[model samples]
Target: MGIRATAVACLALVTMGCASAERTPVTSTAERFLSAAGEGRGGQACLLLAPEAARSLDDCEKQIVSVGLRAGAVRGVDVWGDEARVRVDGDTLFLHRFPDGWRVRAAGCEPRAEQPYECEVKT
Candidate 1:
């Protein structure tokens, strides 16, 4: 009886740890997106897209490569429910949740007074 109770408690602890842990599923998703961007794999980046954007962005894989964005050095990831914001340098990339995973809604950078520095369409 004591061993069974201990086993149950351990399982519960593992479950809780998996949920609130810093590197939760959202974080992993964010990391993968950034890593693909770092490698200049736009098609892979598309894989992270919220459905509509993914469909729209799929055609232009070269754009992803040409942007010269590097994702491997991400500073941090902020997760708020189904939405997560990934910080690369000072820029913030936005994403939406999907049954498949996370998809990019927008990729934002600082110095808000922009000059079309961002291409809203991944294409």
Candidate 2:
């Protein structure tokens, strides 16, 4: 291959790798959060939530579990900057990267026509 063509191919691969790296953590955080909540580990789930999201609930631990989150097979993930959306079998979750790591900002989301997603739990 020509040098220019090789460089372009290498750049494309690097870009794709970065995207995959970002998506992995986002997917992992969403799955972990859902699993924790679904399995009645409310405290663990709450710890995975964004600060403002956790504070939105009066009782973070109890209320997080009551949200009825489920851990399903992850179907898709989109990461933009420090924000990400993960779509699983029965749910979509939004998360933001923090200094510590990624944390769930919203969950149990359903799309609406010409509107933002309505989530059962959000920041």
Candidate 3:
């Protein structure tokens, strides 16, 4: 193959490798966010959010950190198409599976229409 063709082929291979969800892909990127939050890296955690969720709040990372919610593990993931809900430490999180990946819509949450994010974290 020509140099240009070879380079393109190599690029494709690299992309495929980087996009390796071949074996046991994460249930959702929300899990990664929780891991990040648990480690107290709000900015990194905030990066994995659903667009609407991202837009719904201001100063996303700092706001999360302010809530004294470092992070929690996703005990379960219930995915139905683009939307998914996760359970963590008795609290639940809402997420959306975007074209790119999953993002958190709400955290420290429960399925309560009246008070979704009422599971306050200790400061």
Off by over 4 Å in 1: 1-19, 56-58, 111-123
Comparison by lDDT, 2 against 3, better one: 2
lDDT digits (tens) for residues 42-108 of candidate 3: 7887787666665655776776666655446557766666666668675677766667766677777
Candidate 1 C-alpha error for residue 66, in Å: 1.7
- In model 1, the worst 10-residue window by lDDT is 114-123
Off by over 4 Å in 2: none
Instruction: Enumerate residue pairs that collide in model 1.
Output: 48-103, 49-103, 50-103
* Per-candidate local distance difference test: 0.63, 0.94, 0.63
On the 0 to 100 scale, the lDDT of residue 33 in model 2 is 95
Best by lDDT: 2
**Candidate 3: misplaced stretches above 4 Å?**
1-28, 113-123
Q: Candidate 2 at 82: error in angstroms?
A: 0.8
TM-score of each: 0.60, 0.97, 0.62
**Residues 1-123, model 1: lDDT tens digits:** 699999999999997786566335665666676677668787787676566655664464665555555555567777677777667774567677777766776654443465544645432
Number of clashes found in candidate 2: 0
Q: How large is the C-alpha RMSD of every model relative to the true structure?
A: 6.3, 0.7, 10.0
